[model samples]
Target: MYKILAVDDEIEILKVIDEFLTQAGFMVKIAQDAEAGLEILAKEKPDLLILDMRMPGIGGEGLLRELSRKKIDIPAIILTGYARTDAGLGFVKKDSLKILVKPVNLSILLETVNECLRGKRDGQTKDPDC
Candidate 1:
């Protein structure tokens, strides 16, 4: 089973994601903040990361930057209230990174997860099915 790490400040969101992904047969881990997420990253080394872009401290963007600085490469999906055209996401350089806005549908989330992981399996930036 693929290991997935989801980091969000909202406890409810984390719970929902954990339950959903777990039910989908993934080994899911949750972190309530970027700091905790970092610790989990070091220990768990998950295959994928589901990240909330906005948080109290060192939010999603910061975590991504830190990962880059550390030369850690992993597939990621970004959740944010911002739109696709949002200026806040300009710093993100990975072409394969998927950005899903808040109020994302569960089915779409599942589809994205499959596609992203499939790409990882195939050693590509994204699945051709995307």
Candidate 2:
């Protein structure tokens, strides 16, 4: 099973992601915030990262910047409730990773997980089956 680390400040969202991804046959770990996520990233090195775009202190954008600076190329799906503004777009535009607007659909999340784990990067498109 592919290992996934899901990071979100919202406990409810994290719980939902853990439950759904775990049931989908992906091993799941959750971090309540980006700092916690960094710790998990260092140790677990999950195959995919499901991140919330906003959080307290060093939000998802900040975390992505840090990863970029360190040259860590982990595939990430950034979910945000906020409107798709330039602020949210700036960081994600770099790697061709798509941002899923929240609240997200479970099937799409699974599809995205599958895509990222399969090494799909630049030039990714939506799976119609999802």
Candidate with best lDDT: 1
Sequence-dependent TM-score of model 1? 0.88
lDDT against true structure, model 2: 0.79
Residues 82-120, candidate 2, lDDT per residue (tens digit)? 767336545443443657889999999998788776643
- For model 1, how does the per-residue alpha-carbon lDDT over 4-80 read when each residue is reduced to its tens digit? 99999999999999999999999999999998999999999998899998898999888888887897877788888
What number of backbone clashes does candidate 1 have, counting pairs of residues 3 or more apart or in separate chains? 0
Instruction: Quantify all predictions' global Cα lDDT against the true fold.
Output: 0.85, 0.79
The 10-residue segment with the lowest total lDDT in model 1:
85-94
Task: Name the top TM-score candidate.
Answer: 1
Q: Each candidate's TM vs. the true structure? A: 0.88, 0.84
